[model samples]
Target: MTVVFAALAVSRHLQDATGVSIQNLVRTLRTVRSATIRLGRHEITLALDIPAAAQAILDRLPPRGH
Candidate 1:
């Protein structure tokens, strides 16, 4: 599935980009289940807020073998 590939790719990117430990990454993800915000007229919901930074890193990643 694409989901599996994305997760694996991000995991590899995280390993290459950050010194943070795998335990720490997993813990962080566990702790941040979701994030939410509200305004008087509108609301914003982020299901993956905890891993947003990691995903951002993935977004900026160059093609592999570059």
Candidate 2:
């Protein structure tokens, strides 16, 4: 759900609502690493250092429709 994160990363309300943790988001901001993470019609190119757990969740998400 890279798209979701890209959105959530900007939303203070959403960040509070979901309680989703992105240590990667923090790391990326600090270290300036760049990578591409895509979902559905979205392609996000950010320097976010995604944690293993978040990466796993992204990997496990089903594409579009079953």
Candidate 3:
């Protein structure tokens, strides 16, 4: 969820800067199937399936021109 939120925020920023829609930004990210995060100390590892996460974010966004 946190990753999705961060992605959404970045998409929003890119939209503002590039005149692109959030949907487009997210769609471009669909190629990213997964990501790994490494944490120190505990050596925690987190894997994210980006397509699913992108879809989840897209699901929450209102349709364009709303």
Index of the highest-lDDT prediction: 1
The sequence of per-residue lDDT tens digits that candidate 2 reaches over residues 1-66 is 999877766554334433544554344334435788889999988766756655654454346544
lDDT tens digits, residue span 1-66, model 3 = 999999888777667655557677657665765545566655544565567655554556566665
TM-score of each: 0.41, 0.27, 0.34
Residue 58 in model 1: shift from native, Å? 13
Residue pairs in collision within model 3: none
Give the winner by TM-score: 1 or 3: 1
Tens digits of lDDT, candidate 1, 1-66: 999999889787676666555565666556556767998988998876546755554455467787
Task: Name the best candidate (by TM-score).
Answer: 1
Q: List ranges where model 3 is wrong by over 4 Å.
A: 25-66
Q: Give Cα-based local distance difference scores for all models.
A: 0.66, 0.55, 0.63
TM-score of 2: 0.27
Q: 1 or 3: which has the higher lDDT?
A: 1
